[model samples]
Target: MTIELSVLVEEADRFLDAARIQDYCPNGLQVQGRPQVRRIVSGVTASQALLDAAVAAEADAVLVHHGYFWKGENPCVVGMKQRRLKTLLGHDISLLAYHLPLDLHPEVGNNVQLGRQLGLTIEGPLEPGNPRSIVLVGAPAEPMAPADFARHVGAVLGREPLLVEGDRPIRRIAWCTGGAQGYIDQAIAAGVDAYLTGEVSEQTVHSARENGITFIAAGHHATERYGVQALGRYLAERFGIEHQFIDCPNPA
Candidate 1:
């Protein structure tokens, strides 16, 4: 059930449209190791613990939503980066990562998967005018109260979300996973009843209160756990390769 590393990367790149978009970090194939991948480990982030799990699972490739080498990060392979890279190289395991592209993907994307799990039907982009909007808007099949909606998100993601109450019922909602509080303005502009994101900022409260939009800060890791796993599932089915998703939880 081994597939060539090149072939797998190519397929992922094509599926995610990784090249066309500008991202802070490189999208596909962050680290190259084994030429052929028989087993893959997928997770939210490429943290040390997750890498250890991948090694323990004997995974030939490790795929994740978050990977190393950001836009303005230090280029030196020192400290944590060095250790992580060492582990992958030592085990001959490839590192494949996708960030924004994974979030925006129509199928198996973070927002879409999370929305489905929460019984939300997709409406459209959160920012209707932005062609490359990673955030998405969705609605429950039946509208739920603000508090009830928060509970539903917590239940689905297994993380208690911090609810910032708004004045009205939440029918139309928008979300972007993983520390996207900065996009609250876009969500507000979209005129949704509520906005959900991973991390909350100091000003988020003001935004929510002023705009009368319910704000839910679901855990960054919690909200993001699905995209990579979904991609892994797709890869397993498409390529006949074994894939295991290792959950590495983070409270924030």
Candidate 2:
């Protein structure tokens, strides 16, 4: 079953509420292609490898969490950027991407999906009364020691996470997926036992140590893989179109 590209893009934007959120990059339809869409390839990033895979799969469109045209990126389209755009334009494949919206979304967001994978029962947002709050507070099914929790995260994400153990076992914890280590202070203020995010900065370790809250730095790419896959499945189920999620693994 094929749907028009415009219809697909419109529904995706509306579903994610993309226009309302302020993000580093545009949220939807970064590249436009064929008028009719039958297949979509979803991934965490719009890397050249993923684009190549999508082309090989004969995808009509590409969906991702990361797309081109960042706020501070060089506007010139001469080198790598040109190559990536050329691939999509050459093959007539549309690119649709969502960033903060995909993280803040209640159902298929990255944070929610990561919590589900970790067996966490989310209590609420880390920052209450903020509509765009991406950090979330939740508790695992059982309280776990920092080491045990780190092992569990490694098993689930297929990558050994960096752990800074605190004074106590993790009971209430806060998490935000993908390079949100800056939110540790906020999580600490929330009085949680631990904080988890995709990347860890140098200062993050000190903050966790001083505050006596366990900190886990799961890989950025590892943690964000699920949201795009979930969104792809949702669109596939909704529109009765073929959707494939290709993982071009990133070690970071």
Candidate 3:
């Protein structure tokens, strides 16, 4: 079944409320293709490989969390960007991307789904009293050891995370996916036992150790894989369209 591209974007914007959120990039319909979308291929990033996979799948639209035209990125579409756009335009595949909005969604977001996998519900935002707090804090039914929690993360994401141990067992955990190590201070201020994010910086270790908070640098790609999939599933179900998640692995 085919759904209008505008309709898809409309529903997405309604759910994500992109207009309300302050994002680095445009949140919806980055590139237009065929008006009617029948098949959608979703992925973590809108890279060349993902575009190729979408083309191979005969997809009418490509939905992704990471899209082109970032805040500081070179806007001139000459080399890699040119090639990627050429492929999509050649095949008439729409590029639908969501950045911060995807992460902040309550139900089908990366952090939310990650919490679901670990049997935790979002109790509060890490930056409490803030309307748009990206870092979230939650606790499971029972607290587990920091090492055991790291194992659980590895098991769920299918990649071992780099661990920075804390002083005590993890009771309350805070997390934000996709290179959000800078939020370690916020987590520490929140007084959580552990902090989890995608990428880690050199200073993140020192911060974690000094603050006595466990830190886990789970694979960014792995941690971020679920939100786009969840959105794709929702789109498929809502619009009666075919959707497939094409995972192109990136260790970093």
lDDT per residue for candidate 3 within 121-201, as digits (tens), equals 688677667778888899867888889989988998899999999989888889999999999998888789999999999
Top-lDDT structure, candidate number: 2
lDDT of each: 0.92, 0.95, 0.91
Each candidate's number of clashing pairs is 0, 0, 0
Expressed as tens digits, the lDDT of each residue in 135-221 for candidate 2 is: 999999999999999999999999999999999999999999999999999999889999999999999999999989999999899
Stretches > 4 Å off in candidate 3: none
Q: Per-residue lDDT of 78-162 in model 1, one digit per residue for the tens? A: 9999999999999999999999999989999998888888888899787677768888898888878999999988888888899
Ranking by lDDT: 2, 1, 3
Report RMSD (Å) for each prediction in the order shown: 1.0, 0.6, 1.0
Cα lDDT over the full model 1: 0.92
2 or 3, which is superior by TM-score? Answer: 2
The prediction achieving the highest TM-score against the true structure is 2
